[model samples]
Target: MGKTTGFMEYDRKTAEERDPRTRIGDWNEYQLPMAEAELRKQGARCMDCGTPFCHTGILIDGKDSGCPLYNLIPEWNDLVYRGRWKEALERLLHTNNFPEFTGRVCPAPCEGACTVAINDPAVAIKSIEREIIDRGFAEGWIVPEPPQTRTGKRVAIIGSGPAGLAAADQLNRAGHTVSVYERDDRIGGLLMYGIPNMKLEKSLVDRRVNLLREEGIAFVTNTEIGNDITMEQLQNDYDAVIVCTGAQKHRELPIEGRKLDGIHLAMPYLTQSTKALLDANYEANINATGKDVIVIGGGDTGADCVATALRQRCNSVVQFGRHPRQPDERSEDNPWPEYPFVFTLDYAYEEATAQFGRDPRQYSIITKRIVGDENGHVKELHTVEAEKIPAENGGYTFRDIPGSEKVWPTQLVLLAIGFEGAEDSILVGSDLEHKRRKVKAEYGQYTTNLEGVFAAGDVRRGQSLIVWAIHEGREAARECDRYLMGTTRLP
Candidate 1:
C-alpha cells in the first residue's frame, strides 16, 4: 500500500544506535532517532503483497510469526510514506497501546515475517511506528481522552505492566471505572523497574502513565491485592478483576553453593538497579562494581545482565548458555514467516564487545556448580563444555563433555534462567484454578473459576513477550466489557 515500486527502489534501514562505548557510560536510551526522510523511505519499503503476514499474529513452530498485537503495519507504513504522520499515529494507536515500549524492546517478529523479507531486507515497520508516536507527542496530538460518559461498571486491574496498563486503557475507554493496583511503590510494573533504564527510559513510561491518569484511570501503587487488600474486598469493590501480575517467580539454580552470597536473581538485580537510579541513589543494592561477573542463561535477560554489569563497571563479565551458537542464516527447518533462528549481535553484546574487546557470551557451556570462598561469598563458578543431544522423545538435552570441567574466578553470579510462573501468593486466598503454575483462564474468554474475575498476560499464559501481553490485555478487556454490558463494541 506504500509507493508502488518503493520496495524495489529503496533499501531497508533502521534507526542508528548510539556508539556502544559511549552509551555504556550512562543509563540513557541507546537508540538515536532516524531522520524523517529516511524513516519515510523505510516505510515505503512495505510491499503490496496479496497476503501481508506481518500482522497475522500467528504462531509458527511455537515462535511468534508477526505482530502479536496485530498492528496495522501496512496501513501505517502507507500513511508514513505519504507523510500523513497523524493518520499513521491514529492507526498505530488503534492496535498498540504503547508503541514506544515495543519499538525499543520488542524483537520485531513483524519484520521477521514481512513479505519483503522473503527476498531482501524487510521494511523498518518498528522504527516507522516509533516515529509516528514520537511525532504525535511532539506535535501535541496525543492527549487524554477520557470517556464522556461512565457506565457505572468498575474493573480492578492487578499489575501495572504493559498488560495491566493496556487493559486499564481499553476498559476506561469503554466507559468503565478502572482502578489499577501495583504492589510496587510506582506504576509500570516491569516497565518501571524490571527493565534497565538504558533500554527504556522511565520518563517515557511516566509520561504515558500520566496521560492514563488524566484519562480517568485510577492507579493505586504500593498496594498488593491479596495482602494490602484481600480478594474478598477486591471482589466487593469491583465488578471484575483482571490479574496481570506477570510471571515473576524466577527459576532457581538448586546446585552446589546455591545459597552463597553475591549471587542473585536477574529480575531483582535489574529492579534494584533501576530503582536506585530512579531514586537518585546512583548505587544499586546489588552493585557489580569492580567484580568479576558470571551470568547464567541467554536471551534478552542475560544480555541485559551483561550490559548492566558493564555499566556498573565490573572488572570482567561472561555469560553462559546451554545452547550452541545459532547459524548465520535461517536453517531448512526454520523457514519464512517463522521467527528466524539466526544469529545477530544484540545491543548488550555490542556494548560488552566494545568495552571488553570480545563478546561476553560463552555458548555450549553448562554450570556445574558454584564455589564459594571461606566467607560464604561467591569466589568461583564451575562449568563444563557441553553438546546438545537429541532425546528419544524428539526433544534435546545437553551432555557435558568429559575432561571439560573448568573453574572461573568470579565474585558475582546473576541467574537469568527465566521465570517459572506467576507468584503463588496472589492465588493464596482465592479459588482461582491454575495449571502449569499459571492462572487457568482460556485465552479469549480470560475468565477464572470465580465469577466476575478474569486473568491475562504472563500470569495466565506463562512468560511471554510484551506484545503478547498487550494483546491478551486488550482481548481480556473486550471480553470483560462484554460480560459487564452484555453487548460490547470494543475492538
Candidate 2:
C-alpha cells in the first residue's frame, strides 16, 4: 500500500539506540529518534501484498502471528510514506489506545508476519509508529477529547496497566464514567513500575495519563479493591466492574536456599529501583552495587535485571536461561505468518554486552540450588548445563548432563522466571471463578459468572504481550458498554 515497488527499492531500517556504554549511566530512554526521510523510507518498505497478514491479529499454534490490536498497518504505512503525518496519526489512534507504549515495548508480531519478511527484512512498522505518535504529540495535534455526553453508566477498572488503561479509555470515550483503581501510588501499573524507566520513560506514561484525566477518567492510586474497598462496594456503585488486575503472581523457584536474604523476585526489584528514582527521599531496599549478581531466567525481565545490575554498578552479572539459544533464522516448525523465533539482541542485552565485554546470558543452564553464607546471604549458586530432548507429546524437555555441574559465586540472586497468574489475594472473599490460576472468562464475551462483573487482560488470559492486553481491554469495554446500554458503538 506504500509505493508500488517500494519493497524492492527500499531497505528496512529501525530506530537507532543510544551508545550502550554511555546510556548505562542513567535511566533515560535508550532509543534515538530517526530522521523523517529515513522513517518514510521505512514506511515505504510496506509491500502491496493482496493479503496483508501484518494486522491479522491471530495466534497460530498458541503464538502471536500479527498485531493483536488489528492496527491498520498498511494504511498508516502508506500515509507515512506519502508524508501524510496527520492522517497516519488518525489511522494509528483509530485502533491503538496508546501507540507510544506499544511502539516502545510490544514485541511486534506484525513485523514477524510481514509479507516482506518471507524473503527479505520486514517493514519497520514499530519505528514508523513511534515516530508518528511522537510527532503528533510534538506538533500539538494530540489532545484531550472528552466525550460530549455522559451515559450515566459507571465502570470501575481494577489495575492501571495497559489493559486497564485501554478499557478505561474506551469506556470513557463511550460516555461512561470510568474510574481506574491502582494499588500503587502511581497511576500506570505495569507501565509505571513493572517495566524499567530506561525502556519506557515515566514522563511519557505521565503525559498520556494526564491526557486521560483531562478526558474525564478518574484515577484512584494506592487503593486496593478487596482491602481499601470491597468488591461489593464497587458492584453497588458502578454499572460494571472490569477486572484487569493482570497476572502479577510471580513464579517462584523452590530449590534449596531460596529463602536466602539476598534473593528476590524480579518485579519487586524493578519496582524498588523505579521507586527510588521517582522519590528522592527513598532508597532502594535491594542494592546490587559492588555485588556479584546472578539472574535466573532469560526473558525480557531477566535481561532487564542484567541491565539494572550493571547500572547499579554490580561487580559482575550473569543470566541463566533454561532454553537453548534460538536460531539466527526461523526454524522449520516456525514458518511465515507466525511470529518468527529468531535470535536478536534486545536493548538490555546490548547494554550488558557493552559494559561487560561479553553477553551476560548463559543458555541451557538450570539452577540446582542457592548457597547461603553464615549470615544467610546468598554466597554461591549451583547449576547444571542441560540439553533439550524431544518428548513423546511433540514438545521438548530438558535433561541435565551428568558432568556439567558447576558453581558460581554471587551476592545477589534475582529470579525472573515468569508469572503464575493473578494473585490469590485479589480474589479472596469473592465468587470470581478461576481457571489455571487465571480469571475465567471467554475471550470475546469477557463476562464473569456475576451479572455486572467482567474480566480481561492477563487476569483472564494469563501472561501475554502488552498488545494482547490492550486488545482484551478494548474488547472488554465494548462488551461492558453493550451490557450497560443494551447497545455499543465502540469498535
Q: What does candidate 2's lDDT look like per residue over 31-86, in tens digits? A: 99999999888888898889999999999999889998999999999999999999
Model 1: per-residue Cα lDDT over 189-283, one tens digit each? 99888888998999999999999999999999999877888877889988999999999999999999999999999998998888888888566
- TM-score attained by model 1: 0.99
User: Against the hidden reference, what TM-scores do the models get?
Assistant: 0.99, 0.99
Q: Clash number for every model?
A: 0, 0
Lowest summed-lDDT stretch of 10 residues in model 2?
A: 424-433
Clashing pairs in 2: none
lDDT of each: 0.92, 0.93
Name every residue pair that clashes in candidate 1: none
Name the lDDT of candidate 2.
0.93
